[model samples]
Target chain A: MNWNGIAAIWRFEMARFFRSIIQSIVSPVLSTSLYFVVFGAAIGSRIPEVEGVSYGAFIVPGLIMLTVLQQAIQNAGFGIYFPKFIGTIFEVLSAPLSAFEIVIGYVGAAAVKALLIGCIILGTSFFFVDITIQHPVWMIAFLLLTSISFALLGFILGIWARNFEQLNLVPLLVVTPLVFLGGSFYSITMLPPIWQTISMFNPVLYLVSGFRWSFFGMADVPVAASLAAILLFTALCLGVVWWMFRTGYRLKS
Target chain B: MSAIVQVNGLNKTYDGGFEALKNVSLDIREGEILALLGPNGAGKTTLISTICGITQPTSGAITVGGHDVIDDWRAARKLIGLVPQEINLEPFELVANTVRFSRGLFDRQRNDAFVDQVLKDLSLFEKKDNRIAELSGGMKRRVLIAKALAHEPRVLFLDEPTAGVDVELRRDMWALVERLRADGVTIILTTHYIEEAEAIADRVGVIRGGELLLVEDKARLMSRLGQKELRIELRDGVEALPDALAGFDLTLSDDKRSLLYTYKTGEERTGITRLLSAIQDAGLTLADLQTRESSLEDIFVGLVHTEEGEPS
Candidate 1:
């Protein structure tokens, strides 16, 4: 199993994360606070309660989802890409560890980093709004699944990308817009029928909906459908990652 | 000694249709140093990379300590350590942590004492806490060695270990290689410096045009293929060779003050006495006589030149 090898990679990555601990923790926290001020305080005052939950509390899960997705992608993407860029990836490739173990080490560390940021934003939310988790276990499960799935996607992105522009392309141009349009700051039910129908194709919408369901116990879509969406998304990403390693995609020539 | 590393009929062709290695086969003995000598694009690095499992071979089998490098890579890789030619490192990581990280990568149990010893052996103990970016080029090379040794592999591959280091560090590195050999570790180093091989390798392998031209015991190869030159200096300069010395194959110096006579070292009769007698009969007063042996570099150049069908 090469448990020690996996631990070594995990620890090495975590050390890099801790080296920039202040920036890692503060950026998302500050953004989450700003979103609350703009959307929760000022806008919520003019709007009525959203599906029996306060508007401020309504956006908490979406905010966590938004940040977790971004952090997971960026952390895992940069984590693997930097090694490739500096040529230190040769060490990892030549080691006794297998592809599965290597992926676990890198993706696990990145998932943990995103999970930490998600938790911090959750804590920061307590100060801004009154919140309750009707399904705490489900919330944790959703958070873990989303972090791991997106981290896997990020790992694939890292391997597939050849330059900095390509590395940042999907996360910035594709993911950020999807998150904003996928109802991170509002409910999809508030959109028109056609837009709501189109939102069904946005993968991030399911992540936010399932996560919000764990908090308020009221979701725009059925919880089972959202759960299926994330599970299917995770499986798809896993398949791509498996193919990348098996074929030695960008990792080996 | 029994072979600890065996490569059989290995071939590698890159996707771009570049044939980097051509049916290369080799056996590295345990506790002995083998030097691979070649010029650029001669497949030395590709061969090492394949055996270490960094580059996948197009075809052929390789085993380290009786374990297949492909199917049983976990076990085989655990027994090998590699120091690549490039100095790739985490600039922000501490020196000590980099070594420890490599040890763990090999799945070795955490042995702080051993890691510390490796650092001390490399003279990097004082800089253990410093980031890699803070070190000089020579010091970073030391860190690379430290990391490779941290795992304590039975077989080590040093690919151009002394390529860009200073003279003092190169000497120190050579000394360290000898110490490692004393501990019974098998070392294979590829280098452009023929002198490095002559000084340290038990056997020298010459590779040219993606093929291993020869691998033989250092002393035996030197004696078998090496040539010696005898130079006869005369008190007076002559513009042309004398008729009496015409029977011998000799070259006159451009200034015509000395004559050069070449002979094989392995020959039963060099005919030096006959040549000298003839030179004296030619009425040339001998001012000085000297003999010089060809170096490994000379032999290497001759071999490469012969392979290319050039005049040597």
Candidate 2:
């Protein structure tokens, strides 16, 4: 019930983000624009269209997903990790805030950061390709849900990591590859039957499919299945976070 | 004064089987200064951290202002502020914002005026707009104090607050502690500097090997265990101590120019009169006499050495 405490943490984190506003906003925008130039301009010209949507427009949601996923994990991971690294976490630990409030503050700010980057990339996509959102509300929901979920995962990573290298380990080696292989640029339907079957195991595939469905109204997986996948994934992340705080894992001895 | 902070049967055993605390019990009276004196790795920081709810106790109960530190942490924590041993600050954050942030974290309203006053009190008002990284080491320690005081808690724990600071800053900190005590804030500080405890603490506690050896009123602890030495300088040198003075608890200096007599301060009779008479009868003429009292450091060293089974 410590609303002020939660707001304090949120404001403190947002202040840090604002301090590096230029770098935070510009890096992802520039990177997403590059993907548009490389995949939308050069590759889309050869492909023409996939499932009645232009190849360039097809990758827009996927590109936003990619950027949102990476930024969310990175922002939230570094948000908590930096405090641990410098020993300032003692302040938070000693405060009159609850674990739930702490999570709400850290994860909430991180989600907001990821959503900002996602929206900016969405705006940047307008300049690169002609796009229409058939389900704008669903798109926002998907974006918000994904940001919160990934930020929670990032919070876990932050607590678990002992060093900078370990902090970057999962996001780099595990997440980026999963996003790329999960059909960020191409539809899973384009793959062979065997590959498509294997792609079902990749959780990122469902997130991208559901997010893309909100844009094109066509998805590789059924809308309900994609929705279920994302909801289940969010619950899983929440459970892990709850467990972490409950046991004081890596946070208290 | 009533006990504002109470710790009972506290124990902390880390995963590696290292016991940081063992059945530590204490009661800090409201509006008094209690100093915990110990050597390095003596559970001082760990004890503070546990009471502040930064570390979970394996088995214990700690209550601040009648609220349990674990179960009712929100209320318990509202009554406490902690200045940790490390100088940890957000390097990029402005000094004023840093203090404000701590206040907010404790669920206090945004009181810019109060925050400014705290900064001024710590002599950090001039650097309030600067980033923490821009300040010197002493200033950073001041900022830590300001942050801890920002929330205006009833109990404050200062863990080695003057470890590396210069003499002037140390004196300033002592003065600040006195001012806070006058304002009715109970304070507990941990330090290895026996002089710091001697100068400021109303009561002193000594810990070693994760065990609290004792806690008592500063003056009482000194008087109860303290020893005094009387030195009698002779007019002439001698080869050895005379038989007349041998019966007394006395030793001659290597040059035989002086005799040293040791006695407890609590003793009803120091035997000084008898010793002087014996020296006179032994045909020794006194040139001058001097007496010295043992310091807290001396008593601390003796206690620790005795605990370690070493000669004191």
Candidate 3:
């Protein structure tokens, strides 16, 4: 609640951000652009837009989602992860800082990193296609919501991770695939009705679909349902993180 | 004069049925540097972590500055600063920022001037802007100390702070600890280095195998339990001891160049002067004489090694 508490966390995180500024900026931008070239251009011409937009333009939100989610998750994950890795977590754990203080500090930092990546991808998407904003408010809403949600998820993952390799497992293998299956690039409508129904089960579908709706004024999922999923996921991740802090689960170990 | 930390009947058992601490109780007096000495797996770190509120005890209680460590952790933690054995810092952060961040954790006001003084005290002022990874081992250790000191906690715990460190840094660190004690900070140190405990600790607490052995003032414990030795160098080397001197409880060196005599303080004379006169009668001459008191290391080893009571 206090600015100084938040400032303490924000400063530490921002310093880490600047430490790898070149890498954090370059990796996501380059990766998302390549997604545009390969998935948008190479495959788009073969298939028409399922939702009345060019395949290139349709994929823009997904690419943006990719950068934002991964970077946000990693930003928060590494922020907490490296502390335990280098054993400096003892300093934070022993300090007068409470569990809530730690969450706010690290999560705020992650949101900033995810937001920066989202903005860069949105800015650079102009070169590949005619990216238009159908509703700026909703766009900002989904951007903030998705980034914060994933940042919380990453914060939990970082504390639970026992080693460096274990930290990579969730972000790379589990999360990236969930994004792919969540309708980031392809419409669940294009699939058979059975698979489309299953695609609805993926939580990420709502985030990407909702974000895409903000741009094109349409989506396979309803705006209301998307918003619900976003709120629910955010609440869930925050609850789990709070529990980790409260119980001192892997953080103590 | 009251206790800064009061631990009552503390016990800890791991998930696998391994008990690390059992019914341990002690009062850590304010403004005194108490050293906790033990071998590996003696539950030193476990006890310190529990007091810091990072690990929970399976049973019993601890209070720091009259606040229960579990029920009122924020206030209790605010009063205690713990330096773990590891040298972990944010590799990307500057030294000054690291210390400042620690202060802010306690919701303390920003005092750049005080932080600067702490950096200067630790000799980290010159590397204020340097990244943590850029500093050497000793500097990183100092950074941990500076971070712990930044919040100005009343109690500071150093867990094996100088383990694996060189002698020069170890001495310098002990000197700094003495200075902190002079400033009225209560210090609890755990070390495998016996000399550190003997050199700096006002009172020494030894724990072994999940049990508290004894806690006592340094000199009192030394005078009460420590044995003294009298060693005599022989002017003439002998292949074997004479039968006439066999009645004395004396040990001969392997080379037969010297004799060592040990006696309890409660015993008088130990017949040492009589033995010297008898040695001259036996035609053996004395070259030199020396005596030594038992050290803390000797007492600690003797205490822990004999607790099982099988001549181990």
Model 2: CA > 4 A from native: B254-256, B309-312
Query: For candidate 1, what is the DockQ?
Result: 0.88
lDDT of each: 0.93, 0.93, 0.87
Q: Give per-residue CA lDDT, model 3, range B1-312, as digits (tens).
A: 899999999999987888999999999999999999999899999999989977778999999999999888878988988888888787778999999998887667789999999999888999999998899998899998998898898999999999888887888899899899999999999998888899999999999888888899988877767877888899988888777688788889888999888765546666888888777887888999988887888878878878977854
**C-alpha RMSD by candidate, in order:** 1.2, 1.5, 2.6
Q: Tell me how each candidate scores on DockQ against the true complex.
A: 0.88, 0.85, 0.56
lDDT of 1 by residue, B103-124 (tens): 9999998899999999999999
Residue A185 CA displacement from its true place in model 2, Å? 0.5
Lowest summed lDDT across 10 adjacent residues in model 3 chain A is found at: A1-10
lDDT of 1 at A105: 97
Q: Which candidate would rank higher by TM-score, 1 or 3?
A: 1
Distance from true position, residue B182, model 3, in Å?
Answer: 1.0
Residues B157-272, candidate 2: write the lDDT tens digits. Answer: 99999999999999999999999999999999999999999999999999988888899999999999899989999999888888777788778888889888889999999898
lDDT of model 3, residue A88: 78
lDDT of 1 by residue, A143-203 (tens): 9999999999999999989998999999999999999998888898899999999999998
Clashing pairs in 2: none
Better of 1 and 3 by DockQ: 1
Model 3 Cα lDDT, one tens digit per residue, A113-163: 899889989988998988789998999999999999999999988998888
